[model samples]
Target: MVLLLDGDDWLYLHPAMSAFDSAVARGEMPPVTLVFLPARDREAEFACRSELWEAVRDELLPLVAESGVTADPGRLVVAGQSLGGLSALYAALEFPELVSRVACQSGAFWWTPDAPDRPDPLGGPVGGSLAARLRERHGLTGLRVAFDVGEHETRMLPHCALTETLAERAGATVRVSRSASHHDRAGWRHALLRDVAWALA
Candidate 1:
């Protein structure tokens, strides 16, 4: 299944899924099985929260499989934008066997555990908590990950660049690209579909 963790407004805006379907209709790509797992609380559900992951592993996946979606547990792809993007990568790192592929767009790599309370949150760290976790030497040989950031997002460049490099170093088949717009989904539309296709490839 393909999971989409995005802005509530875009919950109905299945640009990537729609594009995938169009591609399939045109014989460009094969049929895909997709599932949308919207985040209840963006910060709470998508962060590196151990409690949240445990609940996801213990309660969510099993329910999703039986939810009549025709999803394959072994062929999972998690896609998210912005903060959701961070969570997608976090899941790939923490639950490697479960998430075989990841599509992250404009991830908030500036996030730090203490930075939220600090005077300068964005300036406090690069790659934040996820970067620290990536340093743990988690082998991602079986994982395929795609990272795309907005070229106009100057503030997010360094952090995202570092993250892309680190994921590749961790042995994931990584694909990196830049979108034309800023952090908005308008800029992420193409990357979203392209990256997901790459991940599934």
Candidate 2:
């Protein structure tokens, strides 16, 4: 089974699965049990914190299992876009055993601990909080992570690029790609499919 992050943003992803389904029909990639974990509060859950992952590990997975879905805990891929993407990568960094594969699209790499009311929240950092974490040099020996950012996301490129490089440096098997459109779903669908395939491969 696979976990798709940011079910609160399901509207952004639901339509895109058709594209993935077409790829599945073409035998381009294997099908996954797409379990969407709706975030009751994205800002809280997807932050660089520990509570959310604990809940996912202790509660959410068991609930899915109880619902009669067969899932291999070892093979879970957590896919997320935007801040959720950031959180997915964060999970891999902090909880490597539970999250081994990640398909992250256009993560909010500009996030800083500074309040959002700051004149330029994006101005203070290149890779934000995650960069500092990445610098810690956690050994991600068996982790596979894919990072995709929109080609048109000029302001976002530096952060994503740094994170991509750092993840690789930390020993993860990493794939980085650029999507055609902006930060919208138009670009992410391609990322969601290609990156997940690369991660699994």
Candidate 3:
């Protein structure tokens, strides 16, 4: 099963979401399952909150287990964009065995100026800080990560670059792409379909 977390804007019902849905209808994606995680909104102060991760750990995981979309945690994939991207990383890092792959598109890795005492707005340190923990526990042997962002996404470009490096160090197979510009949902939608297919396959 694939989990798609909505961004801070909570605009999952937009064109980008449609692109994924359309791909499924066309059989570009396999007979896959999808789950959506709601967003906290663009103005929320603590963007990617511990409270949110609590929901995934205490609530969502069990739900997925019972639903049986993926009986093996290693078959599960999680994805998101922007703040949602942060939430996806948080989920995968915290429960690596439960999620084998992560696709972060145009991720907002600049939530915190410095790593906070708690998980930052993006749920961890800027640029793959959680990777260290993953390696220590999950060992990073089977983890696969796909990261992509537009070249014009200036503020997030550095974080994206650093995150790719961190994922690699953590022993994950990482892919980085920078062919597009930051143009809302349109710029990122195509990458979502392509990366999801590649990772989930």
Candidate 4:
């Protein structure tokens, strides 16, 4: 089953609904079980901490388990765009064996107060170190990663780059697109469909 995670705003459908429906028409839309978490701003206060991720892992796995979509945790995949993309990568890092694939699109990799090379601008070591630490510490032996960002989305490049770096270092198979800029439903649908097709293929 697929999970269509919302972005930081948690209010929009991801890009590729039309493609998804078309896939459904062709019997290709993977069976999906959606779980919409709250907005990133709402969750950021606690996201750096382990509790939030732990809570999601605790809750979502059981639902999938009950549904029989993935009896083995290792077969599950997590995917999202923007903040949701960041969260998907973070979740897979946090729980390696449980998530086999992580599809990130225009991910908010720069959400931290400071970058890996910068000191904590937010006043704590943890603020700038989460992504780096995830890369350095996580075991992603079988993880498959995918990402897409628009060429015109200048503000998002650094974050997306950082995520790509980490995914590559973790031994993930990564993909990127520079044609699709950061956008609403209309903008992301094509990329999402492509990503989902690749992930499930």
**Number of the top-ranking candidate, with TM-score as the measure:** 2
Model 1: pairs clashing at backbone N, Cα or C within 3 Å: none
Tens-place lDDT per residue, model 1, 79-173, is 88888888888888777666778899999888877766888877966888788777776577887889999999999999999888888888888
Whole-model lDDT values for every prediction: 0.77, 0.82, 0.67, 0.61
Best by lDDT: 2
Off by over 4 Å in 4: 7-19, 27-32, 35-49, 67-71, 113-131, 134-139
1-201 per-residue lDDT for model 2 (tens digits): 668886645546456566667877988778866777888777777877789899888898888889897666467888998889989988988888788889999998787767366887667688998988888976787888889998899989998999888889989888888888798876787688888777766
How far out, in Å, is residue 124 in model 3? 14
Listed per model in order, the count of residue pairs whose N, CA or C atoms clash below 3 Å is 0, 0, 0, 5
Model 2 misplacement above 4 A: 11-13
The collision pairs in model 4 are 15-188, 15-189, 16-189, 150-180, 150-181
1-201 in candidate 4: lDDT tens per residue?
Answer: 556665333335333344456777777656554444555553462334456567666886576567665535554556677667767777777667566777667776666633433564233332134457655754566777778877777766666676677677767777777655554545666676677767766
Q: Give the TM-score of candidate 1.
A: 0.89
Q: After superposition on all CA atoms, how large is the RMSD of candidate 2?
A: 1.8
Write down the TM-score for model 2: 0.91
